[model samples]
Target: MSLYSALYSGVSGLTAYSSALSAISDNITNVNTVGYKGTSTEFSTLVTESQTFARYSAGGVRAIPRTLVSRQGLLQSSSSPTDLSIDGAGFFVVRNSPSATAEGAVQFTRAGSFRPDAEGYLRNTSGNYLLGFPLQVDGSVTNTGNVTDLVPIRITELTGTAEATENIRIRANLQSSDPLIPSVVAGTYDVTNAANNVATGGVVPNFSRDIEVFDAQGGTHTLSVSFVKTATPNRWAVEVYAKPASDITTGAGLTAGQISRGTIAFNSDGSLDVANTTPALLDPLNIAWTNGASSSQISLNLGSDSNVDGLTQFDSVSTVISTSVDGAVFGNVTGVSIDRSGVVTTLFDNGLTRDVFKLPVATFQNPDGLTRLQGNAYGVSDFSGRYALVDAGTGGGGTISPSTLEASTVDLAAEFTNLITTQRAFSASTKVITTVDEILAELNQVI
Candidate 1:
């Protein structure tokens, strides 16, 4: 009976060693796989009860394959900007289809060799589509902690964009030595129309400057701000009007291309005096574009109170210095970039960047317990706890390394050493099987 048990034990040894060899073979083959986790076979003894020490029951061996999914892999630079990697814990949530919303279809992976597909959806080589939270125009993301809230990151819809000018600041020196012209009204100056600007029969401004501003439609328009010395000391009447006169429909209190008319007062020290400045700086000037654009508002910012940073008045010759305006013309989408926090920003040729989506990193209680799936992905199992979606580099999640990929966890030297040991063990198991066979054959002959 003991001999019979020994024979069965030898068979178990052969099976266990075969399993170990298989695992080693796979490890050696997948040494270069991106985001690959190596699996190893662990052996355990299966013992049987024996009534007495003299009568010993041979024990068998069992092999268990364990995938080291949690072990981090080395990060390497990648040529593709969409290629992403996590430096620490968690995986990238992905799906099979861009339109998939089912919770069962959700999967997780560390393989970040992603690129935009034909439809502009980001997908990895494994055929799994990358999912992310859609960013609103205000740069806010609303996540319900559910897979349905995630969508495929498609960039093709963002073909082109235009930004309207909202704020403008002018910096220049107004001639303080210019004498107050009696012909120009002192207390209040009304620009009958922009035609008063020409040298013929109209009043010529002492100084004038032109600035370009972008409209809602990305159309460029030039605005001229003309200044005239007034009867009041240290005060000048200013009028802001658009060029070509026909570009904008005239509104009330606006004529001759004038959008706004106000008087600027300067302190005796050559600094701006805001309290005495009429019409207040930063007030929205509403205008209707004749070029079929919607009504838009533009805010003007003169300098701070008693600050010469903007609209300075000095004895120097008057000249237009510089202008700072926020806007961009219509532009084509150039490319996309991802920040360390996993925010995907769409870049345009007009030097504008818009946040498109935010990639979420998923974490689990037992990452090693995940079930291996196709495309270098993993599925949630009972052993692995429920997944939680977290912003990259937040809530203890791993920081996203843009334009990089994670190297496989396998080590060639180590795998080769394991391969040799497994081969030897497997050979020894064959010897055990053959010896048991010989013993059985002897018994058969004796019987």
Candidate 2:
């Protein structure tokens, strides 16, 4: 019986020690594996009586070891535009929904090896869609409270297309006592003597201008505007006409119906005061020209408003003030820049511009607790907690680079060392079995 008890004790030791050695070996093998954490065994005696004092044999094996948490490794940067890596905290959310369901298909990961999917969505290498709020140009995410489904990155050519038209604003002071019947003249006015015609009761002798605007089909339209001295210095007439092409000869002929006319007036002080009558043909026509596609020319004659009582004197006026017709045409996209707040602005090819969108980032509570899916990604789980939304360059999340990537984290030397230890431990366990066999043989001989 004593021999049997000794044999059982040896067997237990051999089995427990062998299991411990296996745990160590596993740790060593995976030491070099990315995102892998090493593990060790914890041995607890079996439930049984000790045979040394009462002749009863000890029974049962010890406890086994398991891996608990994987340590967060250092992040290596590849600087690739698509490669993203977290520096301080938070895990990237991923979805493995083969059917792309809203709630059920979910996972998470720390790896940033992401690419575009079939639908042009930013997905991981494993075809898993990444989860996050859509980044806007302003570096702020839209509807940040809600989480977006797995999707691939959609990168359109940052290049955008644009068209532009310029509305030339012209304001001129025409004198009230010139023999001109019209207050405003819009057309090629063959000014007999523009240099000497400078007259006024507050009206300049002559003022003329030409503006360019784009048609619906992107064709260029030219508008000719002119202000001539009428019969009265304080009452000058206005005229407007449209030419389809840059060369006045190539443009459509201006008809009386297509023509616009108005009047300009002045005060006793010789300073020009402008007001147009309600029936002025150019007032409505100019509105249509600036707002309409084909009708290019528009003229407004500002007749004088008579309520004057102050020391209003005028000497030589060079600039005219325009109260109506305020609009512009964009050229094309030429430049792009983002501010710290994430506001995206685009300069047009024609010197025109506008704001596009805003961009933002997200954070999680227990990033390590996230569930890993395919393609080095992770999804939110009960353990991982909720997402904390933030703008780009805010908190710990860094700004996104236009062209960059992130590398992996693995240790090779540590794995090899663990492998040797496991090998020796395995050999020692085998010797224990052999030694027990020899003891049994000796006991038989003694018997």
Candidate 3:
């Protein structure tokens, strides 16, 4: 009976070692796999009571395979813009379906080799869609960090719309040493009067500048501002013209050659006096376009009332320092990129960048307890606890390193060593079984 048990024990040993060999083989094969975790076989002894001796028993080994899921892997640099890796604790939230279909279960992974498909949804090698929080136009997260708030990041609809020019800020210096324009009377000057043209033996503007402004429909129009020195010290009369003054005829409302929009007055210090400015309340210039395009209201900010942050009058040559307008033409999506904060930015052909999505990193209380899944992914388990979906670099989640991938955690050298020892153990178990068989044959012959 004891000999029979010995044969069974040897068989169990052989099976245990075979399972260990299998685990070692798997580890060696996936050494280059991205985000791959290695597994090892854990052995335990099984015992049964013996009739003759109370403490004596027949025991055999059993193998339990466990994955080293928490082990960290080295990060490798990648050329792809969507490749991402976690430097610390977190997983990228993903889903199998692009449609938020209730049948599809959510998954987590560290294999961030992602690229947008034809539909602009970011998906990994396994075809799982990457999920994140949608960003508002102002670059703020739209929803709380909940599983339901996650959505597939799509950039195909990122073509920007045209924005009409509403505000224009001018920063320049007006020459203080310039002589007053001849034939220009202060407080009684009229921009439409024929006496104001120096070419026609009247007064002419000391300086003038023209800039292009866009209408609501993105049509370009030339707006010219002419400055004339008045009799009053440091005073200059500002007149806005839709075209050259020489081409316009003096008339009420608007004549065929009428080009004057309105006039503004500046103090001796070169700062705009808002109260005394025309269009009455320092209002925006309302241009009535003769072209087929609609009219445009443009606000001209010369300088602040309390500071010289805008236009200034100084004892220097008249020069245009800088001019900026808030507007952009319609453009198509050109490229996409991710930053350290995990914000996906879409670049447009109109030289504009928009934050389309904020990629959230999911972290667990016990990542090692997560259930291992196929394709280098993981699923939720009771031991792992609930996940905390947080912004990258916040709430214990690691910051994302764009264009990098995490390498497998398997060590080839260690796996080879394990292979040698498992092979020897398996051979020894076979020898035990053969020895038991030889003993049984001898006993049978003697009987």
Candidate 4:
């Protein structure tokens, strides 16, 4: 190769190195930036003729290319439920609504650091809505929808009278030895079904109880429950049958007949317990009786009970209790349940019911193939294929940790080393330019 060509090659090398230095510098600067991905340089030679050895400049600069592919660094756990980190593949989709235009509007992200917006929707620092399908009541995603289009996380107080509106769990031990026959005189073994509404007895002895309770609106509902005593020793099956109360004051037709009936076993101790049932229901409708309107009473008329040894008979039963049915009387959040699909639900002291939000997760055809969008976010691309919708901890997604967040994965020491290397390259490139100028000045002086 000619001397001039050799010189050009060196210059090109300097140019490429300088660009690489710049890219590395950029990476170092963002070392503390959450979800930032580092970039590297690439170079190739341009050969005019292979036969002419060293004839061409070390191929002028090839692309001082930015990397479109990178392995996401390991995730750091911030212990924040809202702080999310992708363990394997996929990106946290965020809508860049503020900066969006018709063309290439929504931007995806890797940063899981987010907070609730004023509207209670989860959004990133850029105010982008994280994308994913909203969970349905049945724990199913409706449209495989993206978050950018949906409303923010909803926040508001839910109100209602969580009365044993349906059926107050009835758990009580009817002693095996206790001679309690059905109400009728001739040892009523058979229970009479009146109006085809309440079932007297089947293979199992199941009964329904209707209680009149006022709602948050001071409206009464005729909550019915069906109880089934499974004949299983010390165990019974119970289910709730509920209907709004037509009226609460008059006990005329408000008998323990309208409630859907289920049976639960009472241990030998007479304490009602719902076994193998979640939230365990125990005792005569472990009635979580509430008066959403105000302190009220619902009758528990045993109607008639024939005792053992043919001795005792107890008829009428009734009681009054307070309710948290209105705003002034907010119910306490009680039990929190997560279904198999990771949908979180909160049971309140009040009777009102609701399914708050479904924990969402983004899955990719190839998680490793996802292109980093920085800020701990990833984007879908040809390499990423398509997104596979899923919920937390399912289909290779991470499980959610409520009240926690993920920390930054950046390592300060490693970033500093990279910074040093970039600085050296920058200096070397400047030296090359200086040397070139010096040589040109010498030639001009000699001429």
Candidate 5:
């Protein structure tokens, strides 16, 4: 009985050493793999108790494979902006399929070598799609750390974008010595009358400038700004109307092609007097587009309160200075970039950028207990605590490093040493089996 038990124990020893050698080989092979964690085999003794006091039974050894998943690796820089790596602690939440939203299918990974696929979805080498929360047009996201809110990051859908004009700043000078319109009042004029309206070409403006304003649909519209000095001293009647009167329809309290009609009051010293101006500069120009676009409230920056800037009243000839409008034409997608906070911004050829999405980091209590899956990903296991999705660098999550990747944590020297030790252990186990065989043969001959 003792001999049989000894023989079985030797076989078990051989199996344990074999598993160790296999683990060492795997560690050595993945030394250069990106975000690869090394595995090592640990041995524990298995004992069998004998029924009789004098007899003893030997049990085999068992090998337990442990992964060093929480170990940090060296960060290497890359040229691509999509490459990312965790600097502190945490993994990127991902999914195998772009449309997969099941909580059980969610995965966490340290590998960040991601690139846009044919459909403009960002995925890693193993086809794992990156997940994030999409931002609204107002730059707001209603993310409450819920996993269901995550969606595959797709950048190509943002084909062409147009920015609506938010504000218009005019810095031209108005001639103070100009005579007022003889037929029209200084501050009040009929917008519907053909003989006095600015949109219908009824009254030629003393000083007229064309300004281009962009709509939400990226359509550009020209606005004709006219200034007619009134009989009132230092007061001018201003009317801003859209060109090609069919571009827009009049809203309440306005006429056709009328965007805004106001009166500007200037001090005797050529400075703007905001207290006397009708339709105060604080009010924005309300415009309702005929095309399918949201209504716009255009802010006006005419001039300063005291300085001779913006819409200035000077005795010299009215000179048209530079006018700046805040809006962009239709801009095509040029590229995308990510920041340390995991905010993905889309770049446009028209020099416009928009915040599109934000990546979330998942942290666990015991990362090593995570189940290692194919393609170097990890799934939540019973041993691993529940994951908490958080913003990058917040709530113990790791900060993202753009244009960088984490190298494998396996050490070549250590793996080589372990390989040699495992090899010797296997040889000794084989020797034990051969020695047992010889002893058994002698016992058989005696019997």
Candidate 6:
């Protein structure tokens, strides 16, 4: 009976050590695998009955394999723009299907070696697509924590629509010492009048600047702002012309491809005095296009009425400090990149950038409790609890490191050490079986 027990114990030891060897082998094999987590074999004892003074019992061993999923892997620099890694806790959300609306199972992974397919869908080597929340034009996430709201990040479009110019902000200094233009009657100021031209025996403007504006069809047109000093102190007639005053000979009212005039009055301290000037002149000026393009309403922002945040009449040479207009021509998407906050920005050929999507990282209450799936991915289990999907670098989610990858967590030296110990234990267990068999054979011969 003792020999039979000894044989069973040796078999159990062999089985347990074999399982341990298998775990070690797996760890060593995946040393070069990206984002691979190692596994370890845990042993448990089996007992038949409680020990008593008159009786003795032997116990066998059982092996239980456990995955080291919570350990962090080293981050290595990568050349791809989409390659990403997490320095802290969290996993990149992914899906098996390529369709954005496909009702496929969601998975999580640490492998970040990603490349875009022909459809511009980012997928890893395992063929799982990266999932994220859609972004509005203002760079805000559409959905916060809902998993179902996540969609595949696709950038199939090659170009972005052109936008019309709406607002033009100009900051400049109008020389206060410049001579005033000869003033006619206040109501007789006509931009088309030949007398308005300073080049041909007419009143000369002290300063002028040219700006290009885009229409609804992205047609470019020149807008010229001329400042004429008036008889009133600290007041100047601001005239905007599409063509030079010398080119208009009809002396007719302003027409298409002509000019519009407004008046600006400044305070003694060089601040804008909107109360005394016509509000129509300070409002948005509509420009009619001769090229059949839609008329554009351009807001001329010189400065605030009571503040000197824009145009200033200083006692210096007239100079344009800065000018900015909000409009863009039709452009093709030239490239894409991700930031630390996981915003995927698409760069266009027209020097315009857009935030297309916000990549959200998913974290679990107990990451180690997750069930390991194929291709270095994990699935949610009952013990793992629910996943909390949050934007990257927010709500405890780790910041995404673009152009990097997570290396395997397996240590080759440690795995080799474990492999040697497991092999010795397996050999010792076989010896126990062999010795027990010899004793049993001798006892049978005597009988």
Instruction: For each candidate in the order shown, give its overall lDDT on alpha carbons.
Output: 0.85, 0.48, 0.77, 0.47, 0.86, 0.81
The pairs that clash in candidate 5 are 186-230
Prediction-by-prediction clash tally: 2, 71, 2, 65, 1, 0
Q: Judged by lDDT, which candidate is best?
A: 5
Tens-digit lDDT track of model 4 for 347-440: 6775444566564666666555666553445667887677655666767765544442333344567657756875686576567667766777
When summed lDDT is taken over every stretch of 10 residues in candidate 6, the lowest stretch is: 243-252
For 1-447, candidate 2 gives per-residue lDDT tens digits of 545555565577667767776766666554444334345566676655564664665453564664433345655544344455444444445566534566436554555566655554555566665554445544444544444432323333244533434233344443333344232343323222222222112224355555555543344555555566554445444445454322232213333223444554556665445443326432434423344355443334333344332111244442354533333453544445444443444556655455554434456665556554444555567986876656556775445433223333334565466557645755664665677689888978997
**TM-score to true structure, per model:** 0.94, 0.50, 0.83, 0.57, 0.83, 0.85
lDDT tens string, model 3, 330-388? 77888889999899998888776788888899999988889987778999999999998
Off by over 4 Å in 2: 1-79, 97-99, 102-104, 134-141, 148-152, 156-364, 371-374, 379-404, 440-447
Lowest summed lDDT across 10 adjacent residues in model 4 is found at: 307-316
**Global local distance difference test of model 1:** 0.85
| 441 Cα displacement, candidate 5 (Å) | 4.8
Tens digits of per-residue lDDT for model 1, 388-429: 998888877899999999999988898888888878887887
Top model number, TM-score: 1
lDDT of 3: 0.77
Runs off by more than 4 Å, candidate 1: 101-104, 179-190, 193-201, 280-282
Clash pairs (backbone) in predicted model 3: 248-257, 249-257
Tens digits of per-residue lDDT for model 5, 1-447: 887888888899899988888888888888888888999799999898888989888797878999989999999999999998999889998899877646338889999999999999999887899999999988888667777789998888799788999999888888988776645644445555655677677776778899999998888999888887777788887888889778888766666787777788988888888888875445898888898888888998887787677888998898788899988889999889999999999999988899999999999999999999988899999999999988899999989999999999888998888888888888887887899899989988996
